[model samples]
Every structure is written in structure tokens, then in C-alpha cells.
Target: MQARTVFITGASRGIGAALARGLAADGHRVALAARDGDALVELAAETGGLAVPLDVTDGAALPAAVAAAEAALGPIEVLINNAGVSGSAPLARTDDALWARTLAVNLEAPFRLCRAVVPGMVERGFGRVIFIASNAGLTGYAYTSAYCASKHGVIGLCRALAVELARSGVTVNAICPGFVDTPMAQAAVDTIARTTGRDPAQARQALERLSPQRRLIEPAEVVHAVRSLLPEAARGINGHALALDGGQTLY
Candidate 1:
């Protein structure tokens, strides 16, 4: 693959960090992003990439960040919307504020970021857009109303945007991962303990059963899915919610 600059959100940890490291070694320039400046800086240095620390939910910061990146590197040939909020609550318990916050972080933030950079991608006639979504997006998960809804919205956004930009040579797609071995996933496991008083190992086992593989997914597995989008040949695979859940959704 030709060396291209990639701008990724939520590069501080989890699959985002793995993707950054993987892409950098593949001869691609990566722009590290997250709410934490310190974390972003360390991730960038680790990969010899650029650090553009900012919250994805902030609309005002996006254009400036994109411009700065374009000036420092070239126009972003790849954009990864990986930042998201996981809010778990019963459907009846979900308040308007919780719903709004979920949309802001998981849906609206990526929507705005895509709007900011897609124009340039269309002009350049080359770009790759990947959304790091969740299996909750494809199906319902108990007590995670906000999370499931936000991720479902993300998939909708990707599908529509893919069609809109089909002729522009920019591909938009979402990767839905199931119970990945990340801090976020760990928090979900902790939720099991709190809800039913299960031990840590038992709680983890609950999540493991959600996937047919009966184990938490590795970060590298999800990273590999993101890298698949960078190739020229993968342009045909747009507007899809790819399941990287170890066949969890087969049931």
C-alpha cells in the first residue's frame, strides 16, 4: 500500500491505538486524536505520527484540526471515526440528556468530522472512511439502550454517506466489533458484576459467551479490519456494517 496520511479519532487506547500503530508500520502517516493530550502525544510518538488532541464532540475544533493536518501533512486520505461513548441503561431509564450525549459522541461527532474532511476527499477523488461501531449496532443488547441506539445511528450515517460519496471515490463503512479486549469492554464486564454480583471472572465469562469464540476479542483483530479499508481494491466494499465479532451475530 502507498504511504498515506490517516486521521483517526480516539487514538488514545483500544482498537484505535492498535490501528494507528499498524498503519504507521505499513508506511502510512497517522494523526493521533483523543480528549487526552498526554495520551495522544504518547501514541503519536510511539508511532512517529502526528498528535491532534481534541474531543470528537467539539464541532468548532474539527475544521481547525483538519486544516492543521492538511497543512502539516497532505489532505487526509483516510479518516477513522473511532471515538464513541458507551452508556448503558434500561430503555425506560434513559433520559433525554443521556440520549443526546450518546448521539453527540457516537453519531453526531463522526457525522461532523466526515462533513469536515469529505469535501476535500471528494475534491482529491481519493479517501477511506471507517467507523468503529459495535455489535449492539446490528442487534439489541439488554440495558444498553443508549449505546445500541447511537451505534445503530452510526451505521445509518455510514450507509447514507457511502451512497452520497460513491462517485467521489471515498468509501464509507462501519466495523462492528463484539466484546473486544479493551478498557471499554472491561467496563462492560464490570457492569455484569454490579448487576448480578458475579465475580470478575464470571462477569467476563458472560461477555465471552456473547461471542461464539467464547473469548474476548483481541485489539489487533479489529485493527486488521480497519486496515482492510486502506487498500485501493477495498473501494468496492462501502456502505456495509462489517461484523468482527467472532461469529457472535450468527445466532
Candidate 2:
């Protein structure tokens, strides 16, 4: 397979950073984009990925960032729309501000990235678009109305894009990970502990139990799943959601 430029959002840390390193190591030129300029520079230097620090929610900056990556690494053949946020609040308590921000960051941002990149990918006749969704997208999780809505929206976006690009040789898919062991998961654990008066360890363990496998997934595990969807042959894998939760949503 010829090496192609891979542009990923949320590339500063967690699964995003892992994917950046993994793809770069696999001979693809990777471009990292996120809010933290310093982290972007650090990881780009370490993994030989280009750092394009910008907020995914910022629509104005996205085109320029893509242009920069194209100028540096050639046309992007793969786009990992992995940037997302989990803002937790009960449905009754979810305000417009919180809801809007979650949608903007998690759903709207990826949509913008896809629109910007897919045109080029369609022209090139080969591309991969991977969305990092959540198990929350598949089913309802308590106290996550805004987050659930945004993630579900992401799944919808992926399906629609896959159909629109079916014959264009570009694949669009989502990775739905449940309770991955990342800083975000730890924060969720802390929130559960404080809200429910449970011990942090117990709350964390309870989250792990939501999965049929009864454990938090490793970031690298999700990264590997992402790897499978990013290859050129994955065009047939479009509109599918790979659950990285060890069967958490099997029910």
C-alpha cells in the first residue's frame, strides 16, 4: 500500500495520540490536531507526525489546518475524526449551553472535518474516515443526556457519509469504545463517586462491570481497532461501528 497522509483530530492525548503514533509507525505520514499546542508539538516530534494545533470546534481554523497538512504531507488519504467530549448531566438538568457545546465539540466538529477532507478523498478515489464514538451512542447511560445525544448524532453522521461516499472508494465508520482506561474515564469515575457517595474504586469498578467483560479497555486496544478500519481495503467496512468495550453492548 502506498503511504498516505492521515489527519486526526483530538491527537494530543489518549486514543488520538495513540492512533497518531501507531499510524506514523506504520509508514503513513500523520498530522496531529488538537487544542494543546505544546502536547501536539511534543507528540508530533516523538512520532514524526506534523503538529497542527487547533480546536476541532473551531470551524474557521479547520480548512487552514487541513491545507497546512496537505502542504506538508500531500493530500490526506485518511481522516480520523476522533475528537469528542463527554459532558455529563441528567436530562432535566441539561442546559442549552452544555448541550450546544457537547454537540459542537463531538458531533459538529467531526462533520466539518469530514466535509473538508472527503472531497479530496473522493477525488483521490481512496480514503478512510474513522469516528471515535462511544458505547453511550449505542444505548442510554444514566446522567449523560447531552453526551448521549452528541455521540448518537456522530453515529448518524457516519452512516449518512458512508452512503454518500459508497461508490467513491472512501469509507466512513465509527469506533464505539466503552469505559476505556483514560483520564476521561477517571474523571467519570470521580463524578460517579461524588454523585452517588460511593468509593472511587467502587464507582470505577461499577463502570467496568457495565461491560460484559468486566474491565476497562486499554487505549491501545481501541487504537488497534482503528488501525483495521484505516487501511485501503476497509472501504467495505463503511457504516459499521466496532465496539471496543469487550462486548459491553451485546445486550
Candidate 3:
């Protein structure tokens, strides 16, 4: 694959960091974004990529972030909307703030980022947009109404953009993974242990069991999926949601 400029959000740790390393190793110029400025600096240095530190929820700052990325690395050819937030609460306990915050980070921010970068992509006649959504986007889960709704919206956005840009040589798609083994998943494990009085190991196993493979998806697995969609051969994959959950959601 030719080394194209790639812009990634939530790149301070976990899957986002893994993607920076993997894609940089593949010789792509990367621009890392996240709220953790220090971590982003460290990863940027390690990967020789630019670190744009900011919260994705701040819609007003997204355009400038894209401009900084472009000025540093040239026009972005691949955009990975990997930043997300997950909150679990019963329907009645789910507050308006939690619901709004979830949508802001998981759904609306991606929409804004797409708005900021996609025009240039369409003008260039080549681009890739990949959203790191969750299996909850496709199916419901108990006590996670907010998270599920946000992810479902992400997949919806992905499909809409894919079809809209299909004839323009751009492809938009989503990777829906079931409980990846990351800090995010660890947070869920901690929550389970705290709320249900289960051991951390037990809580983790409960999450792993959700997948038929009885394991959490690895970050490298997600990087591989994102890389798969970058090649010219994948232009035909527009508007599709690729499930990386070990058959957790079968068609």
C-alpha cells in the first residue's frame, strides 16, 4: 500500500495507539488526536506522527485540528474515527447529561470530523473513513441504552456517507467489534466488579464469553481490519459494517 496520510482520534492508548504504530510501521504518515496531550506527545514521537491534543467533544475545535493535521502531513487520505465513550446505566437511571455526552463523543463528533475532512477527500477523489463502533450498535445490551444508541448512530452515519460518496471514489465503513481487550473494556470489568461484587477475572470472563470465541478482540485485530479497507481493492466495500467479533453477530 502507498503511504498515505492518516488521521486518527482517541490515539493516546489502546486500539488508537496500536493503530498508529501499525499504520506508521506500514509507512503511512499519521496524525494522532486525543485529550491526553502528554500521551499523544509520547506516541507521536515514537511513531514520528503529529499529535493534536484536544477533546473531540469540542465541536468548535475540530476544523482547526483537521487544518493542523493537513498542514503537518498534507491532506488526510484516511480518517479513522476511533474515539468513543461508553456508559452503562439502567434506562431510568440514565440521565440526560450521560445520554448527550455519549452522543457527542461517539456519534456527533465523528459527524463533525467527517464534515471537516470529507470535502477535501471528495475533491481529491480518494478517501477512507473508518469508524470503530461496537457490537452494541447492531444489538441491544442491558443497562447500556446510551452506549448502544450512540454506536447505532455511528453505523448509521457510516452507511449514509458511504452511499453518498460511492461514486466519488471514497468509501465509508465501520468496524463493529465485541468487547475488545482494551482500557475501555477494563473499565467495564472494573464497573462489573464494583457493582456486582464479582472478581475482576470473573467480570472479564463474562465479557469474553459474550463472543463465541470466548475471548476479547485484540487491538491488532482492529488495526488489521482498518488496514484491510484502505487498499484500492476495498473500494467495493462501501457502506458496510464489518463485524470483528468472532461470530458474535452472525448474518
Candidate 4:
């Protein structure tokens, strides 16, 4: 694969961090973006990449961050829309603020970032836009209406954009992982333990069992999937929600 400029959001830790490291190791110039400036800076130093700290939910900040990244790393050849928030609440308890915030971070942020970088990708006749979505996107889960709705919208956006960019040499895809062993998943486990009477271990086990593999997906596994999608050979694999869920949702 040719060395290209890459921009990754939510890149302070977990899957996002792993992807940044993987791409950097492969000789790509990477720009790491997240709300955590210190973490992003450390990761950028370690990977020899650029760090642009910004909150993805802040619409006004995105364009500036993109500009800073492009200035530092050249045009973004690959974009990883990985920043997201997850919350659990029944429909009756899911308030408007929660719904809107979820949509903004999970859906609108990626939409805006794609809008920022994709036109450049099209003009250059090369680009990869990958969304780190969730298995919740493929199927509905109880008490996670906001997260599910936002992620489903992400898949919908990927499909529609893929069709529009079919002749443009830019491929769009989403990765849906099941209960990845990330800080986000651990937070979900903590929430379950607090909401129900279950112990933390039991809450984690319940989540693991949701996948047929009965194990939490690793950040590296998701990184490998991202690597697969970056090559020119993957140009034909567009608009796919590639599941990394260990066969949890067989669609």
C-alpha cells in the first residue's frame, strides 16, 4: 500500500488509537483527533503523527481541525470516523437532550467530517471513509434506543454516500463490532451493574455472551479490519457494514 495521509477521530484510545498506531506503523502520516489533548499529543509523538485536539460534537471546530490536520499531514487520504458516545435508557426516559447529543456525536460529527474531507478525496480520485459503528447498528437492543438510532443512521449515511461516490473512486464503509473491550464497553458494563443488581463481572459476562464467540472484541481486531479496507484492492468493497461481531448478527 502507498503511504497516505490519514485522519482518525476519537483517537486518544481504544479502537481509534489502535487504528492510528497501525496506520502509522504502515508508513502513513496520521493525524489523531480527540477531546483529550494530552493523550492525543502523547499518541501523536509515539506514532510520529499530528495531534489536533477538538471535540467532534462541536460543528464549528471540525473544519478548523481538518484544516490543521491537512496542513500538518497533507491531504487526508483516509478518514476514520470513530468518535462516538453510548448511553442506555428506556424510550420513556430518553430525553430530548440525550437524543440530540447522541445523534450529534455519533451521526452528525461523522457526517460533517466526511463532508470536510471527501470532496478532496474525490478530486484526487482516491480516498477511504470508514465509520467505526456498532453491532447495535445491525439490530435493535433494549434500553439503547438513542445509540441504536444514531448508529443505524450512520449505516444509512454510509450506503447513501457510497452510491453517490461510486464513480468517484472514494469508497465508504462501516465496521460494526460487538461489545469491544474498550473503555466505552467497560462504561456500559458499569452502567449495567449499577442499574441492575448484577456484579460487574456478571454484567461483563452478559455482554460477552451477546456475541456467539462469548469474548469481547479486541481493539487490534478492529484495527486489522481497518487495515484491510485501506488498500487499493479494497476499492471494490464499498458501502459495506463489515461486521466484526463474531457472528452476533447474521444478516
Task: Highest lDDT: give the candidate number.
Answer: 3
lDDT of 1 by residue, 1-251 (tens): 88998999989898888988998999898888888888889988899999997888889999999888888888899999999888788889989999899899999999999999999899999999999999899999888888898999999999999999999899999999998899998998898899899999999999999888899889999888888888899989999999999999888
Scored by CA lDDT, what does every candidate get? Answer: 0.90, 0.89, 0.94, 0.94
Minimum summed lDDT over a 10-residue window in model 4 is located at: 242-251
Residue-level lDDT tens digits of model 3 in 1-251? 88999999999999999999999999999999999989999999999999999799999999999999999999999999999989899999999999999999999999999999999999999999999998899988999999999999999999999889989989999999999889999999999999999999999999888888999999999999999999998889999888899999873
Clashes of each: 0, 0, 0, 0
Q: TM-score-based ranking, best first?
A: 3, 4, 1, 2
TM-score of model 2 relative to the true fold? 0.97
Clashing pairs in 3: none
Candidate 2 colliding pairs: none
lDDT for 114 (candidate 3)? 96
Query: Each model's TM-score?
Result: 0.97, 0.97, 0.98, 0.98
Better of 2 and 3 by lDDT: 3
Over the stretch 174-215, how does candidate 2's per-residue lDDT look in tens digits?
999998888889989999899899999999998999888889
Rank all candidate structures by their lDDT, best first, as comma-separated numbers.
3, 4, 1, 2
